[model samples]
Target: NESVWTADQNEEMSNTSASPDSVSLADVSAEKATQGSDTDLEVEDPEKAFAGVMGAELYLEACRLTEVVPVSHFIQNLSKPYVNLNHHGLGPKGVKAIAIALVSNGTITHLELEDNCILAEGAIYIAEMLRENSSLQELNISNNHLDTAGAEAIASLLLDNMSYLHALQLSGGLYALKQSHCVCTFVSLQGNYQVKELDLSHNGFSEKGGQLLGQMLARNTTLEILDLSWNHLSRKGTVALGTGLRGNGALKILNLSWNGIGNEGALALGEALKVNNVLVHLDISNNQINNEGAKNLCRGLEVNGKLKILKMANNPLTVEGATALLASVRKNHNCMMEEINISNVLVNETFIKLLDLVCRMRPELDVIHGEVEGCITKIPKQHPNPMKVIQKYLKEHNLQLWDFFRNIDKDGNMKIPVAAFRRAMMQQQNIPLDRVQIGELVRQLDRHRTGIVDY
Candidate 1:
């Protein structure tokens, strides 16, 4: 015969067996029976038993349900604060599994999934996860095949008020999105206030894209660093962007390199600079800026004082343009210019003398230019060669040549790689040699055709 126990009966049994001294063998047996029944209930409905579990257990369950091959590194990184799964070839399904796992995860703060073939579907999954997850701060999804759909999903995620992401890298795939879709994404970004740094390089942004970006920049205030390098933001687009900059006050660093924004674009930026006071670093290198553009920039520099680093290298500016720019900096007593890079422009005695006077006024100012030209006939025959110029500059500035070499030699090896040497000579603030002189020096130093130069 079997009997059913009611709640009242169970309570009565538990109360009766509350005291160890008054407990009997029958009471102990009943308590054990109740425990076994509860265990059976848990086994019958395991999902209900573990419904609110989080972290690794939850991630593993997601992986199991999605049938994803759990990479060992990913599994290991589930407990870490930073996860790097770059170049893992994790396709849509794999990223979906990871997204499901990370939806409830609170540990990961930085996640890099670059070069993974996570297409549109995978991006959607990630976006959905981000809608729920708030711990993640930085996300790099560059080099993935995220097409228009994926970009739209990401843009929607940014529009969400719950998103806490600070840095977003969606570079290397913007060319796939149509102009309308790109405009949609940029419009979404305009409303976002959380993201501070954005990388949109390697994407061929046309005039439409530029206009969209300009409109976004006009309203968006939280963005600080923007990289628009290696794109096609030519005259019209650049002019629009410059118009946006005119009213913007939050942006500090902007990279517009390799965009063929010519004299017209430069004039637009010059107009923006006259009114804008917050921008600090501006890179307009490799643009088709000529003497007229340089003059336009000088006009801005004369009145504006906030700019610190200006990179105008590889433009078609002549010595006159360079001189005009330096002279503007000299004329502006309030200017805070620190480093000016015009490495592709030749300089003459007039420019050199003006640079010397400017340097004397602002000893910390570093000006970079190319080989001497234009007024070579006026220079005396006793003019020092490029090597002597470098030595003389270093000695006069109280900088050691070995220190420059050591800085480039990262491995502490006595020899510097040819590429590293050239880069250091051209970019290092202490080195006074220009590109043309550096090339000749490299050829003479590397006599054996070895790919390195001995100090």
Candidate 2:
């Protein structure tokens, strides 16, 4: 995020996994149970029958799809705590059979039923099992044909008196992710006080649905992470959510990216941050937030303390809003953010200035962004205001670009030696950057791949 790199800072960051629990099984053995790894017991196929799916075509389908003969062969042991039947060609018949077994079994805590081609009735059976189950903690029911009614039925599990469900991951396949039944699909989960993590990303729930989910957040106490990305939440919907988020405590991370939430929506969320103390991370990228909205968010930070990471990349913020946001963190002790991302928001010059200011003023808070466009696009060779760009960028870090350039300006012209720029950054600002870091900065300023940055 910044030029200062630690010895052990893994740079990769993204959340897209194939399995419900995409954790490493390395060093998984009885001797090292406390060494920090997800260890699920693996046993030989049990001979006992799963009477539920014994004679059904679902069993035949599972057997044919997977060469393991019987799909239930792996889940037959009543003591086994993990049941993963993902992509096993299980339809309604298969899901109902498994549901029948789960109704009586009380051992498994994690269940994966993704991409099984199950429909409404199958979802109903699973919902019934949720009504009675108590030991289960994670449920992955994505990629099934649970139409509107089926989805609502499962959603009502939140209202069930006995359902102790925690994490509900409905991040489904292409069809399921795009198909939404309407507001009812999620309104049933409103006021739910049990689940902690809910992933509704890639779904098509409308703004009305988003509003209802907001109402749920107001009443919920256990929910911590909520992912509603690409759900078409507009400003009105987000404003409604802000009403709930204003005082919410359990919620910490909110991902509303890839939606239609505009400047008003961002402002509303910023207002929420002013009063909400629990939320620490927020991702509102790809929205319509502009300069005013960015300023409003900065104002929120001026009074807020809990928010640690603000990811606002891909918005339409200009230099005015970007600098204000950075300055708020710099001026106010209340807004001690660990990371701020304004990537792809402003132009080449403006972005450089804002980035440099944050890097110098708050060395602990890393600013994340991408290369500037002008440098990348190779603006006019006889650029008129190149000096202004460089000076503004340097001023942000409390350094004079002219002075730094004068020492290396061999011809006494405005142009400076590109090789000396890296050394100047270290000498003037005490920011020691290696080749990788210096090369990255040069790319931002040398958009045209030019060897020298005249500005």
Candidate 3:
């Protein structure tokens, strides 16, 4: 069958209120036969049909059917390839109408509906629409009140073979609702092969949520960039994620800033870096990593070759840690690292000299550090021994060291848990021992690695 409708004829048909029942099958056959030949129809413009069905008309019809107010701005922007209706207050009913209108749409490729108060129901409606539509490539629904069910529905869409989504942003609302575990649905991405970029920042993911994400990263192969910033992934969670990174081969850029992953987490990541060679950019700034963590990371940097950018700014690092990192870069002949950011750490002359040497060796490398404190012309001041510091504190307080140990050892046994020893040291404000010094004291007193120290 061949039907060639002119512009005028198409306009007339769009203006008409006639229902399909008004035209019989015989009438349609006769019109098709009189309009044009099959050869003529083969040359017709494919977009003609889409142009004639106005987006505004389709949206209005959907609004009427759903009993929701139609957004005039949304209708005006529907013809655009990227439609941003962020903060438009489109609740469940409003989004349902838009979803219906967009089901058959072929023009829009990107959609942003952030901060619209669209809850789980709205997310379900969007998931249903995506199941039938294949034109959208990017979707940002951040700040919507999507609970566990809603998140699962959206994640399930990724498993469909026909879905074309490449980038999805679902940050900012789950945390406020105390439903951070909703991110567990992302584990479905383990079987997905289309999504390349995912943003789950500000979700306040707990240790369990981190464990679930680790499971996903361990198996997903198509994901290239992931953003997990501004969450609460402490040491245990971070350690779990690092274990996943050891096996991942496709991730290129990862953001774990502001997650408070301390030295133990840094050690786990160092182990991962020793085996992973695909990651190119890493951001672990503001993670509370100190000298010990920096040294642990350097161990990995000395052997890895694929990483290019390392950002560790705003961390509590000193000259010794900074020097170690630079020296590691110099040792790795195959290292492709180009930039290392430690912006807030103050460096001394020794660190500066080492950085200069590393730069001379690899002219392309850029290291960002804070201003130099001072030049070290003589031997640097050694750290005060924890034992000596404790003795001095006891002498000033007129307290005997044996009495202090007896008080700590309440059970009359010579041994006391390391935690109790640390607590006793912390309570004496005059002890003047920082956490690092306290750790050193524990190490020196408990030489056997036992949980208890012999008082």
Candidate 4:
């Protein structure tokens, strides 16, 4: 009798609230949907059920965590209320189909279909969606194997349906932006609104692409951040880009990392900065910015007042380059330059000691020296080579420092806990995820159990 009463009470409680189909997808995930086994129908409104199905939390988590989702189920049921849809491994046809469906429905906003098999025709479909779908805000189709046709499709979308897009990331070898034979200019400014950020990094763009983008910038208004990293923008390209920056007012962050911008290119950027005052962050890392280039940058810093954060890491900046930055910092009383990432440029004891002194003197600027010392655990010289060998293996595998610790207060999942130490470690290692660690491969989070005994 008591068990029956309890069952009745439980059923009453369950019926009074929402049902599974009516459950808020804002918190639920595809993993949960796949894992759950409940089939009982409960009393719930259709509106609530739809809200739950298309909630922001559920779709975002699904998009962010799982790189692969079944194309059919996702299009039919899942993509109702979500903004970002990052079905990474889904092929171009699948993505285009999904986008077409969403645009037809007129609900999706902020689509991010990065790291997929999307190419030319697929890009055109997305372009069509952009032109017609006025609700979508941001589009990131980066890391896809797209060519000139795809670029032209995107460019067409920019000219027609891409004004609302505040952020666009088309990085990772879509095509060469500067090839002589290519028809599409990097991105035309005909209808592009003053987009806040644009990342064309890692695309094969040389002098021609740089010059094309420069021409767009001369008249275009509103883009603040531009990332052209990993492109082969030689000295000629940099000089051409400088022409656009000479009198620019709204642009701020410019990333030319890994572009091989030698001293001459660096000099051009520096000269542009002398007059351009809006740019705050500049990343010239991984270039051949030798001591001469560093000196030129320092000269620009002296005259310029707006530039703040400078990242020259992984360049050929010897101790002399460090000295140049240190000298510039010493001169400015109100040192606007808050951060300088000089990790592996080979700074000797003298430079290190001088850096220590500079930090001790100012105590305001946080100069990050990413070189490993006894920070994690001391790798003793006298230890057995076998144990050392094991340790090296663990460190290389990223299971040495710590394990994935989840939050007790929030979601009870194995993720990188938000701790000061963990955040610092991630920054040093260049890991970008808020709750996951960057494993060996791109978009692959480290999931191996870190074999460390907790005290």
TM-score of each: 0.71, 0.64, 0.69, 0.62
Pick the lDDT winner. Answer: 3
Candidate order by decreasing lDDT:
3, 1, 2, 4
Show where candidate 1 strays beyond 4 Å. 1-53, 177-190, 374-455
lDDT at position 99, candidate 3: 82
Compose the digit string of candidate 2's lDDT tens values, residues 292-374.
Answer: 88887776888888887788998888767777887788777666576677877544676566656655554445566556666
Residue-level lDDT of model 3, residues 40-94, one tens digit each, is: 1111443532245446786775554334557767887888899988877676656
lDDT values for all models: 0.75, 0.64, 0.75, 0.59
Stretches of candidate 3 exceeding 4 Å from the true structure: 1-54, 176-179, 185-189, 375-455
Tens digits of per-residue lDDT for model 4, 139-227 = 78887766767777777666654546778887774665332114225354452663678888777777777777777667567788888
lDDT of 2: 0.64
Model 2 alpha-carbon drift over 4 Å, by segment: 1-69, 72-81, 172-190, 346-357, 372-455
**Model 1: per-residue Cα lDDT over 19-42, one tens digit each:** 312321122223322322110001
Residue 295's lDDT within candidate 2 is 83
Tell me, by TM-score, which candidate is best.
1
Query: In candidate 3, which residue pairs get closer than 3 Å at backbone N, Cα or C atoms, i.e. clash?
Result: none
* Candidate 3 local Cα displacement, residue 247, angstroms: 1.0
Q: TM-score winner between 1 and 3, please give it.
A: 1
* Cα lDDT, model 3, residue 128: 81
Q: List RMSD in Å for every model shown.
A: 15.5, 15.6, 21.0, 16.4
Once model 4 is optimally superposed onto the true structure by TM-score, how far is the C-alpha of residue 385 displaced, in angstroms?
A: 30
